[model samples]
Target: MEAVDLTAEQRAIIEADASDLAVSAGAGSGKTRVLVERYVQLLRECSIPQIAAITFTEAAAAEMRDRVRREVMSDPALEQHRALLDEAAIGTVHSLGLRLLREHPVEAGLDPAAAVLADDEAELLRRAACIEAIDAAAEVGGERTRALLGLGVYHAGLQLPRMVAQRDAVGAAFAAMGAYSADWPSYVRATLEAHYEPRQTAIRGQAEEIAWQIRRDAGNVTERLAEVAGAVLQPLTAAREAREWGDFAALLAEARSQTNLQSGGNAPAAVNVKGAMKELRELDDDAGKLPAWNEHDEPALEVLAGLRALFEDSVRRYEAAKQAQNALDYLDLELGAVDLLRDHPAVAAAVRGRFLHLMVDESQDINPVQAELIELIAGGNGDGARPALFLVGDARQSIYRFRGADVHRFPAQQALV
Candidate 1:
């Protein structure tokens, strides 16, 4: 093949050894060109049948295939190998996975003629599964379940169908990208620890000062001021001894509920108690500013857990329904391919042998499942001779997160490579 114009970095990438490699470049920086050139170089050493190049989109795959074919045709000596290009694995990851599953149906545990459900068809199946899951949940009634049912009803009335319709995308994010798995309690506690812990000390100090002032002025203080001081002491002591998070939250709530302690009221002692009560109220307000995890957050967490469970249950039901119909979705293609490679060593070896060089485009846009697919296909399982794995992507361009693309995987995958 003729030497094409390439930057120093591009030349380095093309000349890299058979070890795994990751290439990062900005948009319009010839990433795809570098990939094609590298593929052509590999073709010189390996047969076209031994090469596999995966891209993010069908258009990119087609473009890459065309570019490679053009580069091959441009070389007079390489004309004989042009026909083998059509048989090479060059397509989107999903297409490659579907091909893998088709090639090893029994090993993948999928029917040989299983049909892939289109988006609209998958939506129907998902809706059916969600309805079934909701019915099942409703059959078993409890306080939590009732709360879940109410949420389901609210969702149904508001936007449940729309949300369910978009479940494939959202589910993909959760399953592949690890979204919504945050440690909320830890986060809330951390925030409170940072913002409220110091304030707790200040509030306790203020309570002690107020108590001292009341005792010092006891001779001049009215009955009303003494009673108000006792009211303040109750929660002050409770706050001092507050150990559990729930107790602290309750103390804050009780402090906030002292609405009767007005700034100035009809009673004569109200004037004397106003300043202390105002300070206490200010402290209560500060406590309220902290996360309300102990009182109001549990229900939210429970509901969120329930919704996640429902979504998972729906997914399982949806998968069962698809399997029963001998059909699959886009996700199933990658998962089935991965499972096949994982569970059957012989089959994995055969697949690995077929593609001696694996090249992936838009590597930053790949989710964990797709990354695993690439790793398995490239023999990253510490098994036999690992194939040369080449990846090209710009992490800054990883904008397909809604489609399960996780930019964080870029560094991790780079380290793995």
Candidate 2:
């Protein structure tokens, strides 16, 4: 392509030779133009089939492909490469997976002729699976069944499908690593442990330290101030000795229940007393982070676990039903691609060979599954030389969580690159 009147920043982006590049550009800032120009430059050195350009949507992909074709046509020197633009790998991640599976049907363990299920067909199958799951739960007739029944009654039997609709987001949330990864049970357990155990320990330690300081200063303060300080220590001592987790909240409440301690009038001595009282009250307020458990919380926790089991069973039934129809949904498409790349080394190598460079657009909206597929395709396993990875997205623009987008994954992927 001929050189055009471009800003220095746009020229730099097009000319940069970084192995892994991440562009953070806002809308109408020529992000697409930079990507198209960069792609055209790469095409001069690499075959069109050796590069992969992935976008979040088919329309964006088409626009990029069109721009690349236009650039090729604009250059008389690039006349021979015009026909190759039609064969370039430019599409959404789902389309990329579909192409991969189509190329290696046997390795992907699918019937060569198997088709993706239409939205209406998938919804019908999901409904059938939900009904079957409900009937099976009724036969069992236990806590799990009761939870499912309650949810179904509340949502008029749409609860299962609703949860299924959010399967991708839930799965992405669960798959996050480190402190971010926690299921319902794990979250509850962690919260309780933080509040009742480690948090209690820290609170007691801080209270004892403050109590000692109060005792040391009591003799220098007015009699009223000393009296208030002793009163403050009582609740802290009680909290330190309390064995029941339930009593901690009560102690905090008692500590905060003291009034008028901070309302002393404007005498010098009274002002000093009020200042001390204010500090003690602030400590009590800080201790209130430990939430009080309601009488129904224990029972509700039990019901939540049962409901989680029911949801898992429903998901299994839904997958089975889809498999029986030799069909794949959108989630299945992404997951199947990951599995194909991970399990079949020959196929993975073939894919790696086919695409030497990978450019992803709107990458901030990528979920865990799509991220995994990208990593695998880019040889991110540390087993070999990685491909040239180019990511362009504005994390602030990633708002597709209901469709399984995790904005946080962008930073993690950037770190990987």
Candidate 3:
């Protein structure tokens, strides 16, 4: 067997400066063949035999590895360099990221047994948040931030941060409604529709009804709940902080002294002290209003138990929502991973040092995060030394937009060299 021959252009491509080169060859123009020859050349010519070739797919990496082995073993001239070929690393960018992430999990501040976190994890967090929101709203009243977070969590696919930024845009749109108007509503409404797409109409109606009811029942949800809870808790909390232990006694007595203290029950308490009292009461007149847990033949206990269960459920949801916020989202993958590489010199050095050649098969499709990682691996060489930059991709083939890959990244900086 003989070594595969490279055409004149392929020869130029292979022998070109692998240190920093971007071949914007069109599709089906033998770009891969050029890569194979270049890789073999690096093994044969370049003393630096550590080849870390980043491919677009696992299959591509496999094929390249196979080609290199065939080219190395078949040719007597190159057979001596077969050992160098074995040291080559060729794989997808994702595999590379995972490798780096795994090697430096602690440095990344990631759990040793951290899961990639399925989309369901986000949904679980969102559902948990929603449940808490309903309960918190019932007991202590709703929070806009919490509501937004709940909506955002539930709609993880929508990219809440982006949607939130668009909220300002929607506000601007709302302001300029007479002009740039379309099939969109106020940002809030759009969020409502987008967030509640499954129950779009129903959720919208439900949220609207809840909003109106909250307003109607409490007459200004924010002020009512805060004012009510603040007024009561403020006095108690302030009194306690001020060492007014007697105030807490009075606060306790206020509840203990009141009879049919259902005075606050005209509609509902912005806070749930009335219901709390109702549940705490020894009354049996309204068996229907008894708590779920208390409903076991013991009329008074039923009311209290049901109320306790509901409140407990709400509080539990709130806690879950809080925890979900820390879970990894897609953005976490990019941002967190990049942060890990940059912050951990040891891990970064390990990867950057292990890979002598940083070959990105599709430079154009690289995101800021991916590009940043490449730069990190390349030791900020940006087309310099250490892991010699070997990028090959056509600007035209860079079709990915969501991962931050855009036409601007190509030939944008002096890295073009």
Q: Give the winner by lDDT.
A: 2
Residues 133-247, candidate 1: write the lDDT tens digits. 7777777764336546658565732343344544655565345423343555465456656666676666556656754554454345556655666666666567667765457
Ranking by TM-score: 2, 1, 3
On residues 1-417, what C-alpha lDDT tens digit does candidate 3 reach at each position? 223655677778788765667687788887888787787777665543466777765678899889878977887877767766655667766656655666677777776555454445645554554455444544653343333334343443234323321222323434442322232234334444354444323322332332333334444234434344334333333323322223433443342333243244343444444443343232222221222221232333223233323333443553455345544444345566678777866666666666666676766777656666677777453333366777777888876664456666756522744
Residue 391 of candidate 3: its Cα lDDT? 70
Superposed by TM-score, candidate 1 places the C-alpha of residue 337 at a distance from the truth, in angstroms, of 1.3
Candidate numbers sorted by lDDT from highest down: 2, 1, 3
CA lDDT, candidate 3, residue 369: 60
- Better-scoring candidate (lDDT), 2 or 3: 2
Supply candidate 3's per-residue lDDT for 168: 26
* Superior candidate under TM-score, 1 versus 2: 2
Assess candidate 1 and give its TM-score to the true structure: 0.66
lDDT of 2 by residue, 1-417 (tens): 445677888888888884778888877887888889989888777778888989987689999988989888898867878888788899988889988988888888878777787657877877777777777877888867767655654452576666665676554444441232134545665667764787767766666665566656656666676677667668867877776656865775676565346443565655554555566567667667666556766566565555655666778998888777777887778888999999998788778767768999888989888999998988456555556888888888886776768998888778756
C-alpha lDDT values of all predictions: 0.72, 0.74, 0.53
